[model samples]
Target: DPEKLSDAIDCAPRGERFDWLLSVNINGEILSPLMWAIRDGKFALAEYVIDHLLEIRADRHAYYYGREKLFEKHPEVVTVLCSDCPALMDTLMDGLMWHSHSVNQGF
Candidate 1:
């Protein structure tokens, strides 16, 4: 289910400018599980969602679908974590960092 949840989270497209209707979108689509967990006060699941969203995979495509996309879709990620799940703050922060690997992909 983690894979499914992550896929859903990654479905968020940029510049949609769609009206956010509290927990649902103007298109009547439900928000991601991370938002659901936070809205429902389920901190544990929120942590898991955040971890999965920000996980670093050693691949080029990952740059497009990982942390950068997360922040693009939900810039409030850190703000919510800072206030709601302080413990995972370090994990979230660490996940934002990319290992140089001594050679740039020139991205």
Candidate 2:
């Protein structure tokens, strides 16, 4: 089921991977396919979502923090993000420093 789910994500519309969102609810929150992938640690599927999203120039305001969370949990995932979403590289280090400081300060 997971592989099929991943394939569906890879084949979905420009930036709309979770068409099923219309019918399902999780903890009173609507979670997109990208969010599901990130929550499940499916970085490869998340990369596909990000790549397709960038290809269409989709607004990433919702998922940017998800990417940062991914990068924090699995540093290697940043390479995929940097390759597909180069603009992030510009502020990646600065963001990392700020995140580090916040966590160190227990914020």
Indicate which candidate wins on lDDT: 1
Off by over 4 Å in 2: 1-29, 57-107
Task: Provide the lowest-lDDT 10-residue window in model 1.
Answer: 14-23
Q: Rate the local accuracy (lDDT) of all candidates.
A: 0.59, 0.47
RMSD to truth, every model: 7.2, 11.4
Each candidate's clash count: 0, 0
Candidate with top TM-score is 1
Candidate 1 to truth, TM: 0.55
Tens digits of per-residue lDDT for model 1, 1-107? 55555465456552221112123543786676566777778767666666655554444433322565567667897788788777878877766766675765774
lDDT of 2 by residue, 1-105 (tens): 456755655575533443441123579976565556555666665555444333323454543223433344345645744655544444444334342434545
Poorly placed runs, candidate 1 (over 4 Å): 1-27, 58-65, 98-107
Using all chains and alpha carbons, the TM-scores for the candidates as numbered come to: 0.55, 0.33
